[model samples]
Target: MVVGDASLDIDTLVIGAGPGGYVAAIRAAQLGQSVLVVDKEYVGGVCLNVGCIPSKALISAAHQYETVKHASSIGIDAGEVKVDFGKVQAFKESVVKKLTGGVSSLLKANKVQFFQGEVMFINENEARVFNEQEAPRYKFKNCIIATGSRPIELKAFPFGGRILSSTGALALQEVPKSLVVIGGGYIGIELGQMFSKFGTQVTVIEGTNSILPGFDTDMSSLVAKKLKAQGVNVVTGAQAKSAEQTDKDVTVTYTVGDKEEKVTADYLLVTVGRRPNTDGELGLDLINIKMTDRGLIEIDDQCRTSVPHIYAIGDIVPGPALAHKASYEGKVAAEAIAGLPSKIDYKVIPLVCFSDPECASVGYTESEAKEKGYNVKVGKFPFSANGRALSLQSTDGFVKIVSDADTGLVLGAQVAGAEASNLIAELGLAIEMGATVEDIALTIHAHPTLGEITMEAAEVALGHPIHTFVK
Candidate 1:
């Protein structure tokens, strides 16, 4: 079906209706431009249909189950808690349906035309959309490419029912008695820890010496300690060799140092990393779009491609493969297409790992600050010292602040504790606004809120932290 002004034709064409693509289309349409969005799969892409929303739903349920089990400690009396995996799966499906439906409605509301098919670039200004039965070609004045990323399946063990990817892992029919996760990245650790609360014997294997290789060693080590406290068997500096699947379970063979070892489980979750999703029959090469060595599309600060009229954003672009990052880039591309000068601040992009006690950081890490030759001062406040965390019985982590020692400006912030995802937003804004350590410390955060931890951490950086004795 054709949409928008037939006389004016189309102003913008967005390929791949993921977060970035959809947001770009909506923004362009809002600016009184005709927009057409094409996708091979669902409108919401992997983030809504598989990756972010679905996994988070499962994590939420797992957290609730864990809380119920320990309700007595918080003076809330609850009996033995049992999980119905079928119900959990159903709930996740329902959540996806609602969100996907919302995305569809948003597209319709913005007067953006939607096509269900694969899109390939015929040239710089034209694309051909092909479905199972027919292929149609369309020309556009501008385009936004937002094809997202896919999970990197280990060569040793491919994806199947028993040996699952992150997508398949979320669709389990029953909670396995034992689960052996093959990677110690965020996906593996978060999902593995959740299953452990459901009484699954969870083992995490990481090739590196630590689980979260991206974060600071001290913070990630504390996360390991919490996982160990919860009875998760974390094997660091370990490599998986092969996998053998029987009718009952799968046995994973691995090596650590010079010794070979084996672990058997009802299911295996592989979450090594993600690669760019630029492998389809999309004629990217035909259009002469430059790409990175890692296959990510090379775009300028304005999200403009080598072909000036065409643009790209999200995982397919060279940055963190995050939904919010893609969304921001999408807005920038849309505004630029509408004749407005727009650019994204890459430094202010926030990253969050949604584990039981979440981990979040924005800007540079302490190591990164030191590497950049900044005189850095680090400050930390344990959640155990916070009244809100103690009241909620989740005092297992801390909030750390990194600042420019000479200028007292807040350079970065990291938190490894409850609601870290939510708290990181404040830090994101702080960095974006160029707030100093004194600005945060002087702001009166409510007495019993988790946000007070931020103020205290900033105070600690200034050497006048209240509430706890400064060492």
Candidate 2:
């Protein structure tokens, strides 16, 4: 406890009011716990304030701008179109404000006391939250830490001025004339493609052989084709060495094999990866919380940490750094604290990228199933055959399904095309419920719908396809 600090007792104290923490706090309150939530910054966290929502808004706006400019081929002629970036920024900010305000109202309705301050653990059950003025001590029966991660800054390129992080990229007042992106992960690809659509010359330098390295080559290739068509210069297998920034522009030095190359841009955006915000003033060491070498707090199936009364979830825990994953774990952690049998299952967590021809995957790929000693039946159907895709002029991708050869169980599925983000939910539910390819195939999908693509792929798996010729 700090000197001359008043202590407030809480039944549950949740740190970091991001998707994970806010959800956990609400759930805990619903379960009869008097909860208190504290966030150092925005109530909706990075995903709302800067990351997912804002990025998607920009992506959507860019698509509108692109469509209006190039709709002549379809005979829907619109005259010369231009983007007012100030209005775009206004739109994005309005979205953020609405969502974050909703979250605050939810907390108030749930009777969850909210505070905004930096949290530092004083002991196992006590923490001090401090802002610019006062520090208040909080004593809790249970605690949940959901502090999210931040962009990993490379030693060679620190974020400032012309060198920007994802948050910095999203907050740009005006679109840059040119951008050099280091790292080809989902964050890099989404921002790079968004800028390219807005008429910015984007050069993506990736260390691996392909962009979106986590995805299968087939899916990544489609996105790569779209990026190229959008005039994004993709440099695969390239290493970013350093960045030099001036008032007007920035230059990046990189090497591939034996050749060193230099690229100049209006700004440099680095999205290498994210590091968990675990090693801050929140003293996990003081309470001896078991953590990994990478600073991820170790948690059990129910999200319980080494300490029985404490739980950890989201980016600080061991799993994918996804907002949905964090929100799901948040519910589980809150339920577990209330004596519910809630455990985590990583198998059905979906991964999505909002790049052109969006890519989404849940469960095992064919190779992963084979490596795990399962006889897998793979079915693939291209969007080129789908009437809905043809109508949308987005026939550039496919739906691939991986199933158990013996039982026809839907082990996993991948989608790369329009509405891939929304279409993956059914696949995730199928995997979670142990649904089979036969189940999906037998279910009637509306005519000329994107979901029919999944049904056709299941038909391919079951040895009877309607749309495509079987080999």
Candidate 3:
């Protein structure tokens, strides 16, 4: 029987070479399915090549530069710190190339065939893969769509040399002397903060009252204060009208309250949000694959689409548009396709923002927990009181824990401090395993480490924090 359209026979076909697609293809191959992956662009998708890796590389370089600039405060007498933009760019590119090559090798080692082309669904069981020169048909018993999203382009400010998106911002040959970021979400804030650290005069304009609108208001306020302390200008509750470009700079006009103001900068980065890659032209409408109002494919708990043999994952489907989330979903879809019971535990997925002092959160927020009618008990511990933070001289934020008041079960955790992203895994596990405040507090965290803050926060929840006396 012919499956969705591969010219060659295949048991399973995954479209898109993103973290989700490649992972799904490899897993299906390991499960003894003849699998083929179709991708029009570079393998490993945006995360490996442009989005995550490159952004983090810039963050790393900026962090180092900031540390060196402030070395004297930490008792290090390092003098006259200099940044080489070319070297920074080279390092970022090398990291991406290595990771991209690794993904390709893993797929090859697993014996999964790959096609470099744009894919369109021909029917529930068939698809067409086309390159610049030729078009090929692929049919499969099962199909997985993992095409990822792209940066949202605003009509008023078209991207060119002066105006850019997250993708273009990451590929800068030299850091701009000044930057104007259009959105204050994680993508915009993180990149803006990195540029600020790299000595760029950065300005962040958000339509909301504060940065990181997805985060709690208090958290966002605290982050905004930190950004201000770093000499970054944050203009919130402002709406951009348009952008005007000149030979040396670009002027952005925005409305704040009753009046309009104009700000000039060397570069403008737009990071409003992302849109699903599904165009409805992929023959999905013909096959009756349901989609949400936003055009995100509708999938069940098992990652199955309306069509029995077809599945959808990643940015193409609903949920957080994160690579890790997509990768895990890919594994679940592959296992389910192999007749194995697999379900994605969406609650345990952590969201991290790699700003200078990073931010990470998992499970429900305190507000979300309370809205869901759970009597919540909140606990907080500041890094300023942590000895390790004192030694590192990066004491700038805190960790907040939310737990069920009656059951004492960990419900959520939010951290905004040094290496906050790395420290979030324990909290994610705590939430997943339904660990209580006492359970985390009694675990005896190692001394002089950032992890002690986690335990201390739990202890504070128990009304007995040892490090800092809490009244």
Candidate 4:
């Protein structure tokens, strides 16, 4: 061990302390490696602090508030409901604090040393971690980089005052009377719909022809319909040019078709996308590590970078910037470092959106299967016919399963309805186990449950459905 101004040696050093870094540190420690994790901010990183956990907590609160107001349709006859924004913010913070604190306890339990600082590579094997006052050198046998991504800021709309990024939107004290969302992707729509549920008039400006561009049109349409029913104005093919912020509100100038228009709102939120945190300060070039033109680190199947003995995961590497994906890669990278036979196999990475009627998909979609030269068979069952969905009065979407027509092999599945996030996990496991349509159909799902919706959809794919009539 080194005292002040000396280089300390460690078996493994994990950088960034996000889902990828923290999980890798724990797993590496479990494999008998002395692990040390360093991060500049909170231990749980952005996903728990500002991105996923807090946003979902806010969404869950908003959904309950919206649900209570509409319970009369189900004969519940709930009285007038109102939102206390301050309490809501406090609740969201509590959830984040609990999860992040739990993570810290877990790291301690695993005996992995943690430090609060920023890291710069001194070489391929040595690095200096800079805290508030001083920098300490560390030499490690191996290291993993998981710095994650940040919300992309546009030149026209720098985030400040009334101009907000996703982080700023999450931290707002009061719900705006009107909000202009500049992107229609998952983050944009999720936050936009959340604000709408809280009685904020939301106008979504999407550059593409449709919102939720990554999702199939059918799934996105269901969420769009819910947004419209909730009094949201969604404008497609609109380009946000600039924003003018004032003491009270913001005016956003956008163009759709041949005409230019301006809209005024209490705040403007920009959620176009996230960019990798691979530039400036980190000093990847100092180690001669290969990186993409967009500043993403290149990694092999085992999450190993061009430099052996170094691994990169999460948003810094290529693929979807999903927390679960990063965690999975973290495990793989950790096991691979322990000389376990593990590699990255993303054949069934599930993608989910926690919108009004959540959307989730795994494996290959119908179009994707066909594009890959598989004869596609699709079976869709609507939530309108589901007993549980009807009982809850939340039947606005459907479950669709895509399979191989000849073999009845389940290729992919999509669910857009209440509790879709939970429903999609079974399908993801089905794909991972290579289960066929008959396999899912044969499994007895509890009656009058959301899981039955998936079973019925699989039966429909197999050409025999019990819930609904199909030819």
**CA deviation > 4 Å runs, candidate 4:** 1-5
Show where candidate 2 strays beyond 4 Å.
1-6
Overlapping backbone residue pairs in candidate 2 total 0
Ranking by lDDT: 2, 4, 3, 1
lDDT of 1 at 355: 72
lDDT of each residue in 141-259, candidate 1, tens digit only: 99999989998987788888589998888878788999999888888988898888888999999999998778767668878988898899999999999999988999999999999
Instruction: Name the lDDT of candidate 1.
Output: 0.89
What's the distance in Å from true for residue 278, model 3?
0.4
All candidates' lDDT scores?
Answer: 0.89, 0.94, 0.90, 0.92
Give the alpha carbon lDDT tens digit for every residue of 1-471 in model 3.
323333666899998899999999999999999999988888999899889989999899898898889889858888799889999999999999999999999999999988887877777777777777777787789998898999888999988979999999998898899999999999999999999988899999999888898876666777788899999999999999999998889999999999999999999999999998888456778789889999899999989998889999999898989999999999999999999999988998998888757889999899999999999999999999999999888788899999998999999999988999989999999998989999999898899899999999999998888778877
| Cα lDDT tens digits for candidate 2, 49-114 | 999999999999998899888899799889888889999999999999999999999999999999
Pairs that collide in candidate 1 are: none
Question: What global local distance difference test value does model 2 have?
Answer: 0.94
The TM-score obtained by model 4 is 0.98
Question: Which stretch of 10 consecutive residues in model 4 shows the poorest summed lDDT?
Answer: 1-10
TM-score of each: 0.96, 0.99, 0.96, 0.98
Look at candidate 2 and tell me the lDDT of residue 403: 98
User: 361-442, model 4: which lDDT tens digit per residue?
Assistant: 9888889999999999998999999999988888899999999998888899999999999999999898888889999999
